[model samples]
Structures are given as C-alpha cells and as structure tokens.
Target: MDCNYIRGADLSHDSELNQKALAYHADPKPGKIAIRITKPFMTQSDLSLAYSPGVAAPCLEIRKNPDDVYRYTSKGNLVAVISNGTAVLGLGNLGALASKPVMEGKAILFKKFSDLDAYDIEVDETDIERFCDTVAAIAPTFGGINLEDIKAPECFEIERRLVERLDIPVMHDDQHGTAVISLAGIMNGCHITGRSMENLKVVIIGAGAAAISCARIYRFMGVKEIYMSDSKGLIHAGRNDLNPQKREFAASEGMTQKEAFENADVVVGLSAPGSFSLEEIALMAPNPIIFTLANPVPELFPEEVRAVRADAIIATGRSDYPNQVNNVLGFPFIFRGAMDVRAKTINMEMKVAASRALAALTQCEIPPYLEELYGTKLEFGKEYIIPKPFDKRLIVEVSASVAEAAVKSGVARIETFDLEAYRHTLAERLA
Candidate 1:
C-alpha cells in the first residue's frame, strides 16, 4: 500500500496568532453550518418518546390545531431567509443556485450573531406573485421571514403583500436592513458633526431599495427637504416613468439632483460605483456629511472625496474604511430584539427606535471594550461618529432600546421588563 502519511501535525509549535488563525480555519469544514441532533444522549425509551409512538400525541394535537406547531416544534426559533435572484448584491441576478452562497452566509450570520436558526430559501420562479404566494404558504414554519435580493418595485409590492398575509415579521433585508443601518449611521454622523436634521438639505443618489428607504426614514425623522435620483436624472414629482417607490421620495417640482446638491448639507450615495464626482460632491455646504454606501466600490472613494473637502465627514460600506455603515451593525441586533419580544412585524416605530439607539451609543461615553477594539476612546466627532460593528455594547444598548420600542408600539407579544437589567444580561452574554 502506497500511502503518504504525516506522523505528527505540530500546529501548536507555530506562532500563537498563526496557530489561532490556522486552528479556526482547520476546525470547521468548508461550510461550517449544519444541523445536528440537540438531544444526542437519549436512550431507547427517550428515542421512542421523542420519535415514534410518544411523538404522535403532539403531532395529532398539532394536526387538529395548527398554532400548536410553535409549542411542539422549532418553528418559534426559526427564520427563513428567502430570495429570488434578481438583485443579488453588486453582482446582479446570478440565479438561485449561484445566489446560494450569499443566502448561506446570511443564514450563518443570523444563527451566529442573533442565536436564530435560519434556513435559506432560494426560489427559481420569476413571477413575483407566485413566489410571494409560495413563501406566504410556507411562512408557518418560521417565526419571521427575511426576504433578500428580490428586484425593486416588485420587491416593494411583494413585501407589502406578504406582511399583509402573514402574522410573522416579514422584512426585506436589502431594503429595510440597509435602510435601518444607513439611517442609524446618518443620525450619528449628523449629531457628531453638529448638524440638525430638520434644517439639513440632503440629496440621495439612486432610487433603489436602499436609497428610497433611506429617504423615507429621513422623512419620518422630520427631515422634509430631501431629493433622490436614478439613472434618468432626478426623480422629481412629475416624472412620467417614475415608479411608486421612487415617486414617493421624488424631488420638488423643479429641482434636479445636482441642483438639490448645489447647496446641500448632506449627500448620500447609494447609487452605482463612481456615480459622484469630486466637483459634484464639492457643491455641498460646508463640512457636509457624505455616506457613499455602495459595496465593493463606493460612489466616491474616501481619499478622493477628502481631497476635495477636508472637513467633510465620510462613511462607506467597506470594512477597510473608518466609518463603515455596514448592515452588520443593525440586522443581527435588530432581529435579536424583534425575536426576543415576539414582534408581529417590523414597523417604522421600531426602526426609528433602533436608529436612535445606535446614535445614542455613539454619543454616549466610550466603554473600555470599545476603547480596546478601536485602540482609543470614541467620541462624537468627524472620525468617530458611529459604533464599530464589533463593539460589545450593541446587543445590550441597541437591542434593549429596540425591544422597548416594540413594547411601546404595541407590537410585542410578551411583557416588557426592566431595560437596565435586560441590558446587563445582554452585556454579560455579549462579553
């Protein structure tokens, strides 16, 4: 027998950091997430009770009464990350098979970060109503529904209809999740830079899910002066071909995007790569806040934008940058809070509360763990406007605020508890 065998793998002899990295990479298989038996040490009697004969009692009861599934099965702890492959990130529409990697990653993040058991559902159908019906029918299996990467306009209606049909919290993560984080970041950015939301004139590039949602959130925050644009220039109130989503956030009667940005206090770029130029961004008011949240490549590069306006506060979606308005800062924690109180739906009240919580965390005094991770104390300023995604305070501070909002808004199924005590428990768990 010809076999090439290693006698000993001395991984521990390597440098500590290298050993740690290697161990993490080698410990799990290619895709680390999978199902395993929860009650592994069951005896034959336990197996009979859990499986064949004794299990039939609950099964018969659940068959008679449908709502008992949440009591007997894992339905209450599970979420479905459903997607139709029309708008899959920067690499648009790779179909269901290719989109599985992203869906799987989302599932892992949901499980890892929020302690929610998530399963990815990639549908191949192109018809929006069919897909919506299919998902709505299967909604009983999950506590919540996280819709992802379905194309816009259609996505808006689909989400609306699903929420109407299902009793569970139905959200399109690409739309609502991105919007929640962007609003949170924007609130922090404005507060840090000493700008008032009511007086700020903002311009949003791209009238897609993220941009439209951001505009709506801003409007809900009482910022009336906002403008948005798409490929065909500004989405004004009178645009003949404007979709309903874009039309709701359209610019005033006679203003283009560039015109709105000419004296704007904030310019948010949710459009495609290289969409905003230095000259265009330079047209904004003094010390303007700019969030170029396009992934992989921002609408304007941070260094390039900084060259034009040195005092401007800048943020992006990439982790390499200082202020990353990444969805990681919001989604996991938002879902955590939502699930905790058994929220029937994600309403505007909950979203605004989450944003306020995130903003408040940044404005509050910096904690020791934050100082350690960031290598210094965080303050409300140009460079340190938002909390980093890895900040330990998120689960405690943000989730508690969100849960409180859920209770106050009357969407919570469970009774609310002491906010301080809840935060303390969350702090320990996160720590």
Candidate 2:
C-alpha cells in the first residue's frame, strides 16, 4: 500500500483508453468533422439545384423577401459562437484568432449533443458599443447568438443591447450558462441538505458578469440575503471605491466578507484561485452549501473544505471532481429549446425554469452509467448533488422547461409546437 507504488499500479490498463483518447484528438489535420453531402445522396440535378442556376430560384425569392432565407438556408439551425478579444478564458485579451479554439469547441459540443450546426466568429474589436453594433448588424446570419468568454460589465451591456436589437435568441453564455448550471447544482444541494432557498444566506465571491448575473438570478429564485465579494471585500450597498456595477452591491455599514459569511447557508466562489480561505469557510451556517466554481482550480478544494466542515455540500467546476457544475449541461439544451420554439430572446424566466428543470432531473433516480463516471453510488445526497453532463434526460427536461418559459414570457414565435415530438426529432438527429 506504499503511495509511491500507486502511480505504477494498473497504469498500463489505460493504454487502450489513452490510444482512443489520442485518436479522437489526433493532431488536427484540423480534427476531422467535415461536411459531406446528405439526402437523395447528390445526383446531377441535386448538384445543380444546390449550386448553379437552380439555386437562383431561392436566391431571387430571398432577395424579394429577406425572411425567406430561413426557409431556404441552414441559418435556421446555425448559431454563431461570437466573442470579442477582451476576455478569453482565464487568459484575457488573446485577440480574435486566439479565441477561435474555444469557439470551435463550442461548435463541436453543439453538434455532438444537440445536433445544431454552429460556428465561431471572433470579432477584432475591444470597444463594447462598437461590438454591439457589429453583432446587431450581422445577427440575421444566425438563429442564435452565443457570446462566449467576453469580459464582464461590457459583456453585460453588449448582450442586453443585442437582445434588444435582434429578434433571435441572444445570450451571454458565460453569464446565463454558468448561472443556470450553478442554480441546478444549488437546487439539488438545498434539497439534499434540507435547506430552503428562501431561508439561505448566500455569499458569492467575485463580482464579475457571472457573479452579478448569478447573484441576481439567485435573488429571482428566492434567496434574500446575497453577499458578493470581489478582490477588495464585500459588495453590499454603498462603498467608496466601487465601480458603477459594484456600487449596486457595495457594503454600506462596513461588514466584511467574514462577517457576511458568519450566518451564510451557502458560499459560492466565482473569484480567483484560493479566494476562499479555511477561516472564511468555518464561519458559515451549519451544513453550508459551498460551490467553488473557479476553473482549472477551485477557490477551495472539496476535500480541503470538507476537512473544515464534513457535512458541507461541496461542488466545483471540474469534471475530474464529483458534483461538477459544468455549463455544458445548460447551454446546448437551452439553445435547443429556444431555437426549436423560435424564441425571440433568452429571458430570465426561461433561465430560472431551465435551472429548476435541471434540478428536477437530478431528483430522479441516477442512471447506472453514472456509477463509473462519478466513482460513487449516485443518489440524493451531498455527494450526488448534481447530474453529470452525459445524462440524456437533461436535454429534454431543461429544454422543455425553457421552451415553456419562453411561451409564458411571450418570447416564443411558435406558440403550440409539440415538445415531445421536437425532443424525439433532436434524438433522431443526434442518432
């Protein structure tokens, strides 16, 4: 049982797995997925109709009526994974070409799970107002606009203005996507821990776009006392050095983050690495729900926090760890629902409904395949507080909830579409 020998133990057993992994990621002769011809398998007539004089029929019709483009082209199923160079992951300001990889990854995920065709378009501007105008001008080319990895505050304004300008669903995926999944995890966490959202005192670290949006969404979901923190300290009511956005949440009476956490039922870390100190965690209310969602590294590790308080419901943003609150669980299904229903915008009600749907999905019995992935017997408990990304039911459930919300909110263009049939259609497309 020597720890030194552990690295060698059964390591080669994964040689096949490693080879398969390497095969899938094989040095990009640009990584495979090419578009080939589909349906009636391409005859001379098909070729002419798709490309030559025959194509002019649809072109002329579309030119007469621009809305006809949706009837003729792939734009109905196409989403543009758009971003500006200001914020690309934890690596900020990498420019348009540099952010293409993340956008391409989004495309692959869209195709893989939802069978929606998507592509990335990284614009070469940093100015928020200009970027907003640019996306608004080009909005017709896509069925949905997915703003990825853009920096906060600016991201907030850009998405707001674009959704206002465009008819299609415009979303800042980092903000709403992260919030949806986080809400899902928190919902399950609350149910398992026997805590209600109304009674919980939540402390969220990081006042970035995700933090702000999540805080607001948490408020919408019934949490009354939400204490958010940036690098300096607590975001309460009116602190002197606050930015316009931070001023809304600035501490009024000088209550520090520690004092805010003293009676907290949940501590959400959306800040930088190591922002959640052990001392800060020990001050939380009993059976606290802690979600350290900082990437690559969490604000605090699950094991480290559990050492301080064993009963805490701990989750992170990493798949290698248990209870991973991955944003992948939210966006694809969300867009799937929105696009299928031809929703005008991804509203807050839809977002909350999707979150509730996600939470509800986890409340059901765990799938057997999850045992290998989670490395634990999954059930309704602190350890199994959220569903894995591979859970197939998530797509249908969350999408239905979102679509229903869209209808209720009057954002949906298709008022009476069959959701069950649509879900089956997506399943067939993916199959």
Candidate 3:
C-alpha cells in the first residue's frame, strides 16, 4: 500500500465512529469519572461522624500540624488533572470545556492503572499568571498536581512556577510523559543497535512541549548533540525568533527538516503527519532509531521505513503498531510512585529511574499469557522495545523505581522506604 494513501486515509475521522465515541461518554454516565465516598453516610450517626462534629476533630489536628491533612483526608492519594484545553491531544486548541472528556479519560487511567483517584479540573483561564495562581491556590487539596493539555512557552513557565511554589509533586505529563516513554524505547534501541548515547545525533522535529522535554531528558541521559525543528524549520543558534525553550535545543546552523535528518542517529517526530519521508529515513545512519510519533498518522509509516531501511527501529504514538510509545505507560505509574513516597516534585532523577526501569522490564522474559495474548513471543528486540501498557509488571517495576529514586534523591518526605515491601504493596493494591 502507498504510505501517503494510508496517511491520508488515517487523517479522516469517521463521523459514525465519532458519534459512537460521544455516545459511549453519554450513555449510563454523563462523564468518565465521578467522586466516590470511601466511608458510609447511610445513618444519621454516620453522617455526623462523616461531616460536622466528627470532621472537626481531624480539622483541629490538621490545623495544628498541616501535614496531618494527608492522614485525615484523601489528599495523599488524590491527584488533580488540570488542563486549559489549549492543546488537547493532536486535536489542538478546543477550549476548556471541550477538553473535559480527555481530562476525564486521564482520571480513568489513573484509577485503572494505579488505583489513584484523580479529578479533572479544566481551568478556563488562558492567562499564564491567572492559571498558575489558580492552580497554586487550590494545590493544597491534593497530594500531587498533574498539569495537562496546556500549550508550550506558557506551559514551561506554568510548570516551573508551580514546582517552585508548591510543596506537592507537580508534573506536566504532556511534556515529560512522552519523553520518559520514548527515552525508555531509545535506551533499548541503542542497546540492540550497538550505539552509544554520547555519539548519537538526535533530530527532534517540533519544538513543542514534548520535543523540548525529550531534548532535555536526552541531554540528561548524556546525549550531547541534538538538532531541533519547528513549524518555522530548524531551531538553530542564528534564529532570533526562537523562544527560550527552543533555544536550549538550537543547533549552530539552520536547516530544513529534510536536511536535519542527514546522518541522524535518532529522529523524533512530534510534528504533523508527513513531516518526514522514506527518503529521509534512508539517509539516517545505519541501525537508526525512528520515533515518528505523530498520532493518527506518523511522519513516515512503519512499512515505508522498513522498505527503505530494514535495520531501522521504529515507534509511534499509535496502539495498533509495534513498539507503541504510549504515555499511559508513564504518567499513572510515575504519580503512583511519587504519591507513595510523598515526593516534593517529579524531578529528573525520578524520571530517569522510571525510564531505566521500563527499559529493564522489556529485557526480562515475557509472561506466557502475554505471549498467547499477542499471538507471538514477546522479546527485547526491534519490535518489542518497551513494555506494553497492559503489562501488569509496569505497576510494580516503574512505580517502585520512581519511588526509590525519589527517596534516594532526598525529595521524598517519608523517612522510611522499603523497596520489596513497597512492591508487595503495589501488587496487593492491584489485586
């Protein structure tokens, strides 16, 4: 099949399917998530204990020691998934209300994957200061704040200011989620291809939140040379139009996206569909790692890349393909670990640990059930570069790794941390 034809076909969303999605959201429930009371409120005595008189005791204790809120309330296990609806997935800006479903979906994922409760807060304000102020003001109610769907430049500032201001763990999953998961795939890809991080020439197409975060994390992973491109082409040293975030990944010389792919060891496509072609993929160094992550349609499809360079290790943001770099693998579990350890912030150490853990999990033997489910043996090679989101091991592996990192980094508030016991706790929670 012609790749362009496939790309074109994928772009058109079926109205019938769209309506089905809408119906799915509407029927039996108006939204994806709802608040559930953990304690009973059936009797008058239960009500008094649940509220007014009985609540005042914990309130008084919490007033004396602020940290007691975690003990007395659901704050420790609760996370707020806040979004402005500015950048709702690949759909672009659809405003705050329209972004509710996606936010609710995030909450569902949090509950399903980690047993953590999340409330989707769609902040209508677009102004950076107001948005940040609003979240900061309401920050104390939850153990962690998950900033979602906020656009870049402003997103950078919002997350930065929030992290500096709030004591609880704050993370923009759009920025770091893709980065962490992609980094895990890259680590495995490098290992399989016999390439080192230091020598790789990484070309990141799109200087948006994900791209910038990936570039930053790659740098943290000891990747020295990174070339970045946006809608205006290459973000190079000579470009005065570059924002501060883009400037961090700017190369010495500006080049077209096609030119930037020359001899590139890794190509990360976070831009629109058809951003890169098969010819460009052919130009990459031998055993290239290509993460054409543009959703619905990638820059170049897997078949097109394989036709050109069979040695290429390919990944995308889609689930129907092999080595899918889904964010579901990262955010839920990362937050689970963070909240468990009461981490102050989702720092670089925690993120690196998560990536390493994910990469390591793929190398271990795949379970017999998983092999039967996929109808093929799963291994740590080209097609199976990272662990599947449904893989139950992720909860134990990634979460524990992140929790351990948080404690070791001194960011964890809790004094005592036991790794094995924590793993068992996670297993029991899942059970």
Identify the candidate with maximal lDDT.
3
Assess the local accuracy of residue 327 in candidate 3 as a C-alpha lDDT between 0 and 100: 93
lDDT of candidate 3 over 135-169, digit per residue (tens): 99999889999999888878899999999999899
Off by over 4 Å in 2: 1-28, 31-34, 39-43, 64-66, 372-376
Candidate with top TM-score is 3
Clashing pairs for model 2 are 235-249, 236-249, 236-250, 236-251, 237-250
Which is the winner by lDDT between candidate 1 and candidate 2?
2
- Which 10 consecutive residues of model 2 have the lowest summed lDDT? 1-10
Candidate 1 stretches with Cα past 4 Å from truth are 1-28, 60-68, 374-377, 415-421, 428-431
Which residue pairs collide, candidate 3?
A: none
lDDT of 1 by residue, 1-431 (tens): 00012112232423575666556645766543688666654699888888898899999999999767778988877889888877776555667776776788788877766667898989997697899889988988888888887777678888999989988788888787777777777787777667778888888887777777788889888888888888778878777888777778766677766687897888888766666678888898988898997665577879999999998999988777777887767777777777667888889988888888887888777778767976765677788777887777788777788878888989988755677777776677645
TM-score of 2: 0.90
Model 2, residue 28: displacement in angstroms?
Answer: 4.5
